[model samples]
Target: MVMSLLLALPLAVGLWLVTGGRALAVVLARRITAATAGATLLLAVATVAFGAAVDRAWLPELGVRWSFGVDGISSPLVLLTAGIGVLVALHAWVEVPPGGSPATFLGCLLVVEAGALATFAARDAVLFLVAFEVVLVPMWVLVARYGDAHDPRARTGAAQRFVLYTAVGSTTLLVGILLLVATAGTADLRRLADQAGAGLGSGTQLAVALLLVLGLAVKVPVFPLHTWLPPAHTTAPTAGSVLLAAVLLKMGTYGLVRLPVSVVPDGFARLAPALAVAGAVGIVWGGLVCLVERDLKRLVAYSSVAHMGFVVLALASGSDTGLQAALYANIAHGVISALLFVVVGGLKQRWGSVDLAVRRPALRETSPRLGFVLLLGLAASLGLPGLAGFWGELLAVYSAWTPAGDRPRVVFVACAVVAAVGAALAAAYALRVAGLVWAGDRPDPEAPRTPDTTGVERWVIAVLAAAVVALGILPMLLLSTTADAVARIGGAR
Candidate 1:
C-alpha cells in the first residue's frame, strides 16, 4: 500500500492537473499539486523510517515486478525528491513560467515528480530503467516549451541537445540491461546484488558495465559527455532547473551506483581507475569553467559537473567511506544546487536578467532576503565545514587517496589531489558569484528597484536554508542511513 501510494499518488495528481476541468486553473493546479505532493512527501518519510524493501511481482513471465522499496542509500534520496516536489509545486504556484497556463506548467512539474518518485523506488533492473525513462519527456517539455523566451532558438537547441544526448545514453543503458540480464540469467536487482558477479565472466561483465555506464554517464554528464547540461539548465525554467539539479541528476549517479557498482563488481573494478580519472577531470573542468562564466544559472549548472565529480570519484573509490561520501554528496548537492537555482531564478525574476555586472547592488541592498540566502548557498556550496556540502567532498577525496578496492594507488591519489584543487576553485567561483551579486556599486542605479522575496519565497528559502544547516551540523543523519547499505554493496575498506 505504501509503495503503491508513493508512486501512484503524485502521478494521479499530475494526470488530473493536466486533464481535469480545472486543469487550466492556477489556483486549482496549485491546490491539487500541493495536496498530492504533500501526501507523497509523507509517504516518502514513512518509507525511510521503515527502511524496508518491498517487491511485488507484476510481470512474472517477463521476470519483472512492481518492486518498490528504500534502503539507507535510497531512502534519503526518496525523501529529498518528495520534499523538493512540494517545494517546487509551492514555488511554482506563484512563479508560473511566462506565457503558459498555470495548469500546464504545474501539471508537467507534477509529472516530473511522479517519474522521479518511481525512479527512486524501483528495485528491479527493468523497473529502474522504465522509471528512468519516464522522467525524460516531461523534463524535455519543460526545457523546450517554457524556457527562456528571449532566445527561443537557443532554448529549442538546448532542448534538442538534451534529448539527443540523453536518448543515446538511454539506448546504451537498454543494451547494458539486456546484457546483464542475459549474462546473469535474471533482471532482478536483488538477485543480482546477491550473486555479486559470480556467474558472469570478466569479459562479459566489462562489456555490460561499459554499455550501462555509457548510458548513465551521459546522464551524469561525466566530463567529455557533459556538454548538454549547462545549456539545458540555462534555458530551463526555474522549476525545471530545480528538478533537474535536485532530483533528475541523481537518477544518473544513483543508477550508476545501484546498477553497475553494485551488480557488476568485477566490471566496476575494471572501470574504477579510469572512472576516477574522468571524475577528476570533470571536477577540475567544472570548477574552472564556473570561474569564467558570467551567467549565474549556467555557472551553477557547470558547478554540477564539478560537484557530481565528487560522487563519481566516491563510486569509483569503491570503499565504504567513498560510497558514503558519494551518497552524502549526492543529497547535499541536490539541496545546495536547488537553493542556488532558486536564488538565481529569483534574481532573474526581478532584474529581468542575471547578468552579474548589471544586477550587482540590487540583490543585497534592495532585497536582503535574496542576499542572505545567496550567501548561505555560497557558503554551503563551497564545501564549508558544518554545512551539508562538506562531507561528500572531504570523504570522496579521502576515499580516493586511500581507495578501498584493488585499484591503482597512483591514479586514485592523483585524481584525489586534482579534486581537492577543484574544491578550492569551487570556493573561488562560489564566493566570486556571491560577491558579484552582493558587492560593488549599483551598475544600474536607475534601472528601477526590483522587489524583494515574497512571503512564500521567504518561507521557501528559510526551509531550504534550515535543511542545508541541519545536514551540515548532523551529517550522521544521512551517513547513518547510507553506511550500512553502501557497506553491503561494496564492502567498505
Candidate 2:
C-alpha cells in the first residue's frame, strides 16, 4: 500500500492537473499539485527513517514484478527528489510561464516527480528502466513548452537536441538492460546481487558494463557526449534548469553507481581507468568553459558538468570511500545547482540579463540578503571547507590517491591531480561570478533596482542553505545511513 501510494499519488496529481484544467481554476490546480508534492515529500522522508519496501509480482509467467523499494543508497535521493519537487511546484506558482497555464506546468512537474520517485524506489531492473524513461517525457515538455519566450527558434532547437541526445542514451541503456536480463534470467535487483551478478564470466561482465556505461554517460553528459547540456541550460526556463541540474542529472549518476558499477564489479574495475580519464577530462573541460562563460546561468550549467565529474571519478574508484564521496557529491550538486539557478534566474528576470558587462546586478547595494545567499552558494560551490561541496571533492581526491587497485596507480593519481586543477579552476570562476554579480561598485543610475528576495525566495533559499550547512557539519548524518548499503553493493562485507 505504501509503495502504491508513493508511485500513484504524484501520477494522479499530474493526470488531474492536465485533465482538470477546464473544470478546475488555475489556483485550485496549483494548490492540489503542491499539496500532493508536499505529501509525497513526507512519505519519502518517512521511508528514509523507517525503512520500507514493497515487492509484488506483476507478470508471474515471465518472472517480472511490480517491485519498488528503498535502501540507504536510494532513500536520500528519493527525499531529494520529493523535496525538490515541492520547491519547483511552489516556484511555478510564483513564475508561471507566458502561456499562463499553471495547471499544465505544475502538472508536468508532478509527473516528473512521480517518475523520479519511482525510479529511485524501483527494485526490479525492468521497473527501474520503465521509471527512468517516464522522467524524460515531462522534462522534455518543460523544456519545449516553457522555454525562453524571447527566442522561440533557439528554444526549439535546444529542446530538439535534448530529445536527440537522451533518446540515444535511453536506447543504448535499453540494450544493456536486455542483455543483463537475458544472462541473469531475472529483472530483480536483489536476485541478481544474491546470485553473484547472474553468475556470469568476467568477459560477459565486461561487455555488459561497457554497454551500460556508454548508455548512461550521455545522460551524465560525460565529456565528449556533453554537447547537449550547455544549449539546454542556455535556453530552458528557470524551473527547467533547477530540476535539470538538481534532479535529472542525478538519474544518470544514480544509474551508473547502481547498475554498471555495482552489478558488475569486475567489469567496473576493468573500465575504471577509462572512466577516470573521461571524468578528468569533463572536470577540466567544464571548469575551463565556465572560466570564459559570459552568462551566469550558463556558467553554473557548465559547472555541473565539472561537479558531476567528481561523482564519476569517485564511482570509478570502486571503494567505500569513493562510493560515499560520490553519493555525497551527487546530493550536494543537486542542492547547490538548484540554489544557483534560482538566484541567477531571478537576476535574469529582473534585469533582463545575467551578463556581467551588460548590466551590473548591484545585488550588494540593492538586496543584501539575495547578495549574501548568492555569495553563500558561490562559496559552497567552490568547496569552501564547511560547506556541502567541500567534503565530496576532498574525499573523491583522496579516493584517487589510494584507489582499490594497485595496477591503476598511475591513471588514478593523474586523474586526482587533474581534479585538483579543476577545483582551483572552479574557485577562479566562482570568485569571478561573485565579484561581478554581487561585489561590484554601485551601478549606473539607469540600472533597475530589482526588489530584494521575496518571502518565497527567502524561505526556499533558507531551507536549502540550512541543508548545505547541516550536511557539511554532520557528514556522518548521511554516511552512517549509507555506509552499510554501499558496503553491500561493493562486496566490502
Candidate 3:
C-alpha cells in the first residue's frame, strides 16, 4: 500500500496536470506540484524505512507480476529520485521555461519523477522495462516543447535525437528482457538472481548479456553512444537539465547492475574487458572535450561522461569492492552533477549565454555565492579530498587496478592507468572552469555583473551543496546502507 501510493501520487497528479489542469495559473500549478513532490518524498522515506513492498499478479498468462519494492540496492536511488523531484518542483518557483504552459511543464517533471521512482522500485524484469519506458515520452516533451526558447530548431533536433536514440535502446532492451524471461522461465528478478543463470547455456547467457549491455549502454550514454547527451543538455531548461544529469542517466547504470551484472555474471565477465576499455576511453574523451568545450552547460554535460566512466570501470571490475565502488560513484555523481547543473543552468538563464571563451565579469566579484558554489562543485568534480567526488574515483581506480581473478589483469591495469590520466584531465578542466568563470578574465569594474543566486534557487543550491559535503564527510552513510545488498549480489560469503 505505501509502495503503491509512492509511485501513484506523482503519476496521478502529473497526468491530471498535463490534461485537465493545463489551464491552471502558473503560481497555482507550481504550488500544487511542489506539494505533490513533497508528499511523494515523504512516502519514499517511509517506504524505505519500513521496507515496504507490493507484489501481486498482473499478467498470469505471461507469468508477469505487479511487483514493487526497495532494498539496500534500490533504496538510495528511490530517495534520490523523490528528493530530486521535490527540488525540481521547488525550482518551478524560480523559473518556468517558456516553451509551454507552467502546468504542463510541471506535469512533465512529475511524470518523469514517477517513472524514475517506478524504475528504481520495480522487482519484475518486464515491469522494470515498462517503468523505464514511462519516462521517455514525458522527457521528450520536456526537451522538445519546454526546452530552449531561443532556438526551437536545435531543441527539436535534440529532442528527436534523444527519443530516437533511447527508443532504439528501449526496443533492444525489451527484446533482451523477453529472452532472459523465456530462458529463465521466470519474470521475478529475485528468482532470476537466485538461479544465477544456472540452467542456461553459456551461449544463451552471452547473447542476453550482449543485448542488455548494448541497450543499456546507450542510456548510460557510454563513450560512442553518448553523442546525443551534450546537445540535449545544452538546450534543456534548468529543471530539465537537473533531472537529466541527476536522475535520467542513473536509470541506465542501475539497469546495468540489476540486469546484467547480477543475473548474467558469467556473460558479463566475458564482456568486462571490453567494458573496461570503453570506460577508460570515455573518461579521457569526455575530459578532453571539457577542456576545450566553450559552452558551460555542455562542458558540464561532457563532464558527466567522464564521471560515469569511473562508474562503468568500477562495475566492470567484478569484485565486491568494485560493485560497492560503482554504487557509491553512481550516487556521488548524481548529487555532484545536480549541484553543477543547477548552478550552470542558472548562469545560463541569467547571462543569456554561458560561453566561457567570451570574457565576462568575475563571478566571485559579482555573484560571490554562485561563484563559491561553482568552485565547490568544480573542486568535488576534480576529486579534491574531503569532498563527495574524491572517494568514488579513488575506489574506482583501485578496483580496476586489482580486478576479479577471472578478469584479464593486464587489460584492467592498463585501463586503471588510463583512468588515472583521465583524473588528471579532470583536474585541468576543473581549474580551467574555476579560472574562467569563477575568477573572471580581467578586473573590469565596468563590466556587467551577473546577479547572485537568491530565494528558492539559492536554497536549492545550498541544500545540494550541503548534501555533497555530508556525503563526502561520511561516505559510510551510503556505503554501509548498500554493503549487505552488494555482498548478496556479488555472492560474497
- The best candidate by TM-score is 3
The CA lDDT at 173 in model 3 is 96
TM-score of 2: 0.97
Off by over 4 Å in 2: none
What lDDT does each candidate get? 0.86, 0.84, 0.93
Question: Model 1: runs farther than 4 Å from truth?
Answer: 21-23, 51-54
lDDT of 2 by residue, 74-167 (tens): 8889989999988887886657776447788788888988998898888888888899899787778788878788878877888899999999
Per-residue lDDT tens digits for candidate 3, residues 212-283, read 999999999788999999999998898999999899999999999999999988989999999999999999
Q: Which regions of candidate 3 are displaced past 4 Å?
A: none
Instruction: Report the Cα lDDT for candidate 1.
Output: 0.86
lDDT of 2 at 322: 93
Best by lDDT: 3
List RMSD in Å for every model shown: 1.6, 1.5, 0.9
Query: Could you tally the backbone clashes for each prediction?
Result: 2, 0, 0
